[model samples]
Every structure is written in structure tokens, then in C-alpha cells.
Target: MEFLGIWIAAFLTLCIYSFLYRDNPFYRFAEHLLVGMSVGYIIILTIYFGLIPYAWDPIQKAVTGEASRWGFLTLIPICIGLLFFTRLSTRHAWLIRYPIAILMGVTSGIMIPNALQTDIFAQVQGTLNPFSVIGTLSSFEIFGAILIVIGVICTLTYFFFSVEHRGPIAGISKVGITFLMIGFGSAFGNTVMGRVALLIQRVDFLINDWIGTIF
Candidate 1:
């Protein structure tokens, strides 16, 4: 059964990779299969992990006297969730906006602090403490930290349009542009390397696993 699964996986991988040559039925079949499977898996997970655990179980416990009356309050969110389906009805579509507004407000309230902490506060804290590592880290590590601090300042300066880019500012902004390009190029290279890694894995399976099993 494991060998059979390997063969099936190899065939599907080839079907997906076939798009590199040209668009064809095999590629479309593999693409649709992947999307359909992903959606179906998500639906199953939502029902089992989300709906049953958070909604249905609580409602059941409340009704059966296994928990306090507060458990019944779960129905409130369930009703709000059901309101999302009202988008299908033209006359009642406005009901969907209530849930959407609540979702957006609640999500933003939760995320804003987190975003600030991670993106702004954390970055500032790290940048400000570059010299703190001097006692523990080697000279090269200290130098790298200093370079990071310089790169961050330059990048932020490049975005500061309030100050006119003149003389010193212009030179600093040009250096910022170089750092930005390097960051972008590194990101692109990592993405390409990730894809190449997947390709290598597939090629290895074809050569060593599937072909070896058949022979």
C-alpha cells in the first residue's frame, strides 16, 4: 500500500510539473485536484475542530445541564455566523454587514496591539540594543549587528518624505535604496531556492524511490 501511494504521488507530481512544458489537461486535473482536496480538508477541519468544539459542544452541555447557563451564550455567535449566509439573499444582504463589522472591529482590536508589538516596538527595541551584544558576541557578530542598525536607519530615512532629499539626505537615501534592493534580491533568491528544493525532492523520489520500486 505504501509503494502504491508512492507511485500515485509520483504521477501527481509529474502532472503538476507538466505545466512547465505547456498548459494541458494533466496540469489542470492536478491543479483542480489540489484545490478541491485543500477546500474539502479545510471544511472537515472547521466542522470538527471549530464548530463542534467551540459551538455545538457548548450548546449541548448547556441544554443537558452539564455546564452553567453561560454556555448557551455560544448561540449568539452562531447566529451571527449564520448571518454571513444572508449574502445570498438580495433583500436581506444588509444583515451580513453587522457580522462583517463586528468581525473587523474585533479583529482589529486584537491585531493592532500585536502588530505594534511585533513590527514597531520589537524592531525599535532590537535596533536600540545593538551594542548590548558587544560583551558576549565576537567582533564579526558585533559588526553585523551594527550593519543591521545602519541598514534599518537608512531604510526608514528613505521613506521619510517630510524631509527633502538634499545633499546628505540624498546620499543616505541612495544607500537606503541599495539596502532595499539587497533585501528584495535575498527574498527572491530564498523563494527560488525553496522551489528548487521541492523540485529536487520530487526528482529524487522519481529516481530513487519510484523507479527503484518498479525495477
Candidate 2:
């Protein structure tokens, strides 16, 4: 069984890597199989790990008088979940909006404060430093901080559509564009590095584990 699994994995890996040469049926088959398996596994996990443990068990306990009234509250989410199935019916598809709205409202209510704190407050706090650090900051640190502050101001100014980009505004906007380019380049480099790392891992696995087993 283990050897069979290893051969299957190796075959699938080769199938996927075939895409590097050109698009082929082997790659497409592997990709579709992976996606279908992922979706099926997720559905199974949701039924067993999520619905069964949280909703089904609680409702069963409530019905059996093994749990308190609190257990009955689990039925609320179960009903909401059932509403998703209504989407299969053309006439009842509109009902899906209720669950979607409930989810959106709850998620937005939960995430708004967190987003403000992390994206806004935390960033502002990070960008600002006390002048008291004058003695602690090296010349390089001071220069870097000034550059960051300038970059931020220029970037913000670039977004100001009220004034036309002329003279000083043009110069500032150019600086802003430079900073944006640098940020984008860094992000692309990181993405490439991540993919390279994944490729390296797969190659290592094929060389050390999979092929070694055969030998």
C-alpha cells in the first residue's frame, strides 16, 4: 500500500511538472483531479468536523435531554446552513441572500475594528517615532526614517486629485511612483522566491524520498 501510494504521488508529480514543457492532457488531468479531491475532502471535513461536532451533536443532545436549552441554539445555524441548499432551486435561489447577508454583516462587524487597528492605527504608530530617540538613532537610521516619512507623504500626495500634478507636485508624484515601483518589485521578487522554494522542496522529495525508496 505504501509503495503504491509513493508511485501514485510520483506519477502525479510528473503529471503536474509536465506543464513546464507545455500545456498537456496529463497536466490538465492532474490539476482537475487535485481540485476535485480538494473540494471533496473539504466537504467531507465540513460534514464530519464542523456540522457533526457542532450542530448535529448538540441538537441530538438537546433532543435526548442530555444538554440544556443552550444546545437548542445550535439549531439556528443548522437552519441557516439548510438555506444554502435552497440555492439549487431556481425559485428559491433568492433565499441564499439571507445567509450571505447574515455572514457579511457579522464578518464586517467583526473585522472593521480589527482592520482599523491593524491597517490604520498600527501603521501610523509604526511610522512615527519620538524625537527623544535623537541620541539613540545612528546617522543611517535617521536618514532612513526621514526617507520613509518623505515616501509616505509623497505617496499620499500622489493620490490627491484636487491639485494638478505640476512643478513640486510633479516631482513628489515621481518620487511616489518610484516608491510604488520599488514596493511592487519587492513583492514580485518574494513571490518568485516562494515558488522557487516550493519547486526545490518537490525536487528534494523526488530525489531523496521517492527515488530512494525504489533503489
Candidate 3:
């Protein structure tokens, strides 16, 4: 059963990979199968994981009267969730804004503290190294760290339009762009290699399992 399942996965995987050639009935069938299976699984999981734990079990406990929970707060989230369906209605569409605004406000509030903590405070913390250090950790490491800090500052300056740039600022901006492009290029290369690794893994599975040998 395990081997059969493995081969079936490989065959469908090839069907998905056929998109590299061109789209056809096989790709369409595989795509539809993926979508259908994902939706069915999500629905089943919603009932098993979400509804059972949050809704059904609570209601069951409430019915037994041994549990003194009021279940009123649960109704609030349910009602807010239903407000999403208000998109279909022309009359009460304004009701959807309440939940949307609430979500946006909550998200913005959460993100502000997290962003400052992670991005700003973390960068400042990393830059607090003392000037003096020992043998192997020579002046080169300090120079490299200084270059990184300069890169970050100049890159941020390139985006600032509060003042005009001409001589030294323009030179710094050019350096910033060059540093940014090099960093971005390296990141993109790493991302491509990771994706290629995943492709190789899937292809290896197909060859070893489906073909019964790597040929």
C-alpha cells in the first residue's frame, strides 16, 4: 500500500510538472484533482478540528449543565464570521466594514510593536559592539560590520525625499543601489537553488518509485 501510494504521488507529480512543456488535459485533470482534494480535506478538517473542539464539544458540555460556561462569547465570533457573507448582499454590505475595520486596527496595532522590536531594536542591538577585540576577530570583522551599517543607512537615505541630493549624497545613493542589488541577487540565487532542490527531490522519488529503478 505504501509503495502504491508513493507511485501514485509520483505520477501526479509528473502530471503537474508537464506544465513546463505546455498545458493540456493531463495538467488540467491533475490541477482539478489537487484543488478538489484540498477543498475536501479543508472541509473535513474544519469539522474535525475546528467545529468539534470549538463548537460541538462546548455545546455538548453546556447541555450537560455540569459546565457553567455561557457560550455567548462564541456567538460573537460566529456572527462576525457570518458578516463575511454580507459581501453578497447590497443592502447590509456596510455591516462588513465593522469586522474589516476591527481586523485592520488589530493587525496594525500588533504589527507596529513587532516591527519596531524585530527590525529597529534588533539592528540597533547588533551595532553595539565595542571597538577593541582579540586575535582572530581582527580589525577586518569591524570593517565589515561598519560597511554593513553604512550600507543599511545609505540605502535608507536613498529612499528619503525630504531633502534634495546632488554631490556626496548622490554618490552614497549609487553605492546604496549597488549594495542592494548585490544583496537581492544573492537572495534570489539562494531561493532558486532551494526550489531546484525540491524539484530534484520530487524527481528522484518519481524515478526510484514509479520506474522501479533510477535509470
Candidate 4:
């Protein structure tokens, strides 16, 4: 069974590799098979992994009086998941909106504060801590840190539509834009290097594992 699985995986890998030659029947078949299997796997996962263990088990326990009152809370998520299937109904499709709203509300309430804390505050903190005054430590590194903090602040300020931005603020905003561009350029360079590394790794793997074994 394990060998069969490994061979199946190898066959699909070769089929996918055929795309490098040109779009052929094997590649096309593999692509569609991948999509179909992905959707099937999702359905199976939702039913067996998600719905059964999370929604059904606790409800069963609650029914048998082996659990507490909070076990019924599982029903909320269960009903929400079931509501997603109601898109098949003609007249009662509106029932899905209730669950969607509940999900969105809970999600936003959790995400918004977390995003602000992690993204905004953490970024500000990182930029601000370049110069810690203990004795007499005035360094060019401190200047760079201060500039980084300033750029982050100005860039954010430029996006602030609520207040009037003029004079130095406009210049600062431009500086921020420049800083953003530099950061993006650096990130793109890193991404290109990463892709090259992955390509080299894949070639090494193919040569060592498959080509070496076949010879």
C-alpha cells in the first residue's frame, strides 16, 4: 500500500513535470484531477474532521447529560456550518445571512484589535527604540533608527484623510513614499533569490532521488 502511494505520487509528479514540455493531455488531466480531489478532500475534511469531532461529539455528550451547559454553545457553530448548506434551498436562503453576520461579527471583533496591536503598535515600537540614552552614546545607527521612525510616522500621516497635511508634512509624506519604495525593492530582490534557491533545490532533489535511483 505504501509503495502504491509512493508510485502514485511519483506518477503525478512526472505528469506535472510534463507541463515544462508543453500543455499535454497528461498535464490537463492532472490539473483537473487535482482540482476535483482538492474539493472532494475539503468536503471529506469538513464532514469527518470538522463537523463530527467538533459539532457532533460535544452535542452527543450534552444529550447524554455527561457535559455542562456550555456544551450547548457548540450547537451555535454547528448550526452556522449547517446554514452554509442552505444555499440549495430556494426560498429560505436568507437563513445563511444570520450565521454569516454572526461569524463576521465574531471574526472582526477578534481580528481588528489584534491587527492594530500587532501591525501598528509593534511597528511603531520597533522604529522608536533606535536611541536608548544611558551614558554618551550618539551613533549614526541612532540617526538611521530615528529616520526609520520618522518615515513610518510620515507615511502613515500621508494616508490620514481626516486632517489637513501641508508644508513639512507633504515633504515628510514624500520621504515616507521613498522609504516604502526602497523596502519594496529590497523585498522583491529577496523573493527573486528565494525562487532561484527553490529551483536549485528541486533540481538537486530530482537528480539525487529519481535520476540516481533510475540509473
Candidate 5:
């Protein structure tokens, strides 16, 4: 069974890789299979771990007097969730907007403060305290911290469009542009490296596990 599983995985891996040559039925089959399996797995998890445990079980417990009567309140959100299916019917599609608006309002309310705290305030705090390492850290560490401070300032300056881009502001913004390019290049390189790592793993599996098993 282990060998059978390995062989199946190897075949699917090759099927996906075959897309490098050209599109074909094998690649399509593998793609669809992966998507179908992923969706099926998510649905199962949602039913067992989410809906049954949180919604149905609570309602059952409430009925049996095993839990608080407030468990019936779960029906409100369940009905709201059911509203999402209204999108499939042209006449009742407008009802979906209510749930969507509620979702957006709640999500934004929850996320706005967290975003401000983590993204804006945290970044400002970090940038402001770059020199905090000066007394305790090595020169290289201090230089790195200074570099980070400079990068953050310049990057922020580049996005500032209030004043015209001339003279010192222009020069700093140009430095910001350079920093942006370097950041983007590093990100691209990292992504390429990740893909290369996956390729290496697949190739290693094909050569070692599949071929070695056959031999």
C-alpha cells in the first residue's frame, strides 16, 4: 500500500510537471483532482469541526436541557448564512447583500484597530527606535538598524505626493525608489528560490523513491 501510494503520488507529480511541455489531459486531470480533493476536505472539516460542533450540537443540547436556552440564538447566524445561497436565485439575490454588509462591517470593525496597532504604530515604533541598539550592539548591528531606518523613511517619502518632487525631496524619493526596487527584487528572488526548492524535491522523489523502488 505504501509503494502504491508513492507510485500514485509520483504519477500525479509528473502529470503536473508535464504542463511545462504543453497543456494536456494529464495535467488537467491532475489539476482538477487536486482542486476537488481540496474542496472536499474543506467541506468535511467545516461540517464536522465547525457546523455540527458549533451550531447543531448547541441546538441539540439546548433542546435536551444540557446547555443554556441561549443556544437557540445560533439560529440567527445560521439563517444569515443561508441567505448566502439566495445569490443563486435572481429574484432573492438582493437578500445576500444584507449578510455581506454585516460581514464587511463586523470584519472592518474588528480589523481596523488591529491593523492600526500592528501595521502603523508598530512600524513607527520600530523605525523611531533604530538607535536603541547603539550602546549594546556591535557596529554591524548598529549599521543594519540605521539602514532599516533609512529604508523606511525613504520608502515612506516616495509615497508622499503632497509636495512637488524637486531638490532634496526628489533625491530622497529617488533613494526610496532604489530601496523599493531592492525590496521587490529580493521578494522575487525568494519566490524563485521557493519554486526551485519544490522542483528539487519533486525531482529527488522521482529519481530516488520512484526509480529506486522500481530497480
Candidate 6:
């Protein structure tokens, strides 16, 4: 059984890698099989690990007086979850909006404060440290910090639509464009590097785990 699993995995890997040559039936079959299996696995996991344990069990306990009074509130989320299935029926599709709105509202309420704290406030704090720039520091470190401050100012200026881009604003906006391009290039390079790393890991697994087992 172990040997059979290895061969099956190797075959699927080959099927996926065949896409490098050109799109073909083998790649399509592998892609479809992967998606189908993923969906099936997710459904089973949701039922057993997620819904039953968290939702169903709590509701059962509440009904049997085994749970606290607050445990009955679990029925609210369960009813909201069932509302999602209304999306499948054209006439009752409007009912789906209740769950969707609840999900979005709760998510946004939770994420907005954290997003502001981490992405905006923390960034401003990091960028404008007077001690790092003005106090004792190496020339290179000070220069880098100064450059970052300038880049940030320029980038923000570029997005400031209230003032017309003329005279000094034009030059600053041009500088902002250069910084934007550099950031974009760096992000793209990081993405490519990540994909290459994943490819290497998969190849190593195939060579060491599967192929080495036989030969």
C-alpha cells in the first residue's frame, strides 16, 4: 500500500509537471482531480472537526441541559450558517444576504482596528524615528533612514490629489514613481523566489522520499 501511494503521487507530480511542456489532458486531469479531492476533504473536515464539535455539540449540550445558558446562543450562528444554503435557490437567494452581511460586518469590525494599528500607525512610527536619524548612528544607516523618509513623503505627495502636480510637486511625484517601481520590482522578485523555493522542495521530496524508496 505504501509503495502504491508513492507511485500514485509520483505519477500525479509528473502529470502536473507536464504543463511545463504544454497544456494537455494529463495536466487537466491532475488539476481537476486535485481540486475535487481538496473540496471533498474540506467538506469532510468541516462536518467532523468544525461543525459537529463546535456547532452541533454545543447545541446538543444546551438542549440536554448539560451546557451553560449562554451555550444556547450557538443556535444563532447555526441558523445563520443554514441561511447560506438559500443561495442555491433562485427564489430564496435574498435570504443569503443575511449571512453574507453578518460575515462581512463581523470581519470588517474585527479587522479595521488591527489593520490601522499594524499597517498605518506602526508604519508611521517606524518611518519617523528622530533618535535613529539624529542621534549617534553610522553614516550609512542615517542615509538609509533619510532616504526612506524622503521616499515616503514623495509617495504620499504623489497620491495627494487636492494640490495640482506642478513645479516642485511634479519633481516629487516623479521621485515617488521611481520608488514605486523599485518596490514593485522587489515584490515581484520575492514572489518568484518563493515559487522557486517551493519547486525545489517538491523536487527534493520526489527524489529523496519517493524515488529513493525504490532504488
Instruction: For residue 138, give model 6's deviation from the true position in Å.
Output: 1.9
Which segments of candidate 2 are over 4 A away from where they belong? 130-132, 159-170
**Model 5 misses residue 152 by how many Å?**
1.2
lDDT of 1: 0.93
Worst 10 residues of 3 by lDDT: 128-137
TM-score quality measure for candidate 6? 0.88
Better of 1 and 2 by TM-score: 2
Off by over 4 Å in 5: 137-140, 161-168
The runs of at least 3 residues in candidate 1 whose Cα sits more than 4 Å from the true structure, single-residue gaps closed, are 132-145, 161-169
lDDT of each residue in 71-128, candidate 3, tens digit only? 5456666777679889889998889997898889989999999999999998776765
Candidate 3's TM-score reads 0.83
lDDT of 4 by residue, 13-93 (tens): 788889999999999999999999999999999889987889888988888888876888998787787888777898888
lDDT (Cα, tens digit) per residue for candidate 6, span 69-179 = 689898899999999999999999999999999999999999999999999999999998754557677878888888999999999988999989999999999899999
Q: Rate the local accuracy (lDDT) of all candidates.
A: 0.93, 0.90, 0.81, 0.80, 0.93, 0.92
lDDT of 5 by residue, 87-153 (tens): 9999999999989999999999999999999999998888767576568878898888888888988
RMSD (CA, Å), each prediction: 2.5, 2.2, 3.0, 3.1, 2.1, 2.2
Candidate 2 local lDDT, 76-185, one digit each (tens): 88898789999999999999998999999999999999999999887876777634476798898888888888888888888888999999999999999999889899
How well does candidate 1 score on lDDT at residue 53? 98
Output the lDDT of residue 74, model 5: 88
Model 1 C-alpha lDDT per residue in residues 2-58, reported as the tens digit of each score: 999999998998998899999999999999999999999999999999999999999
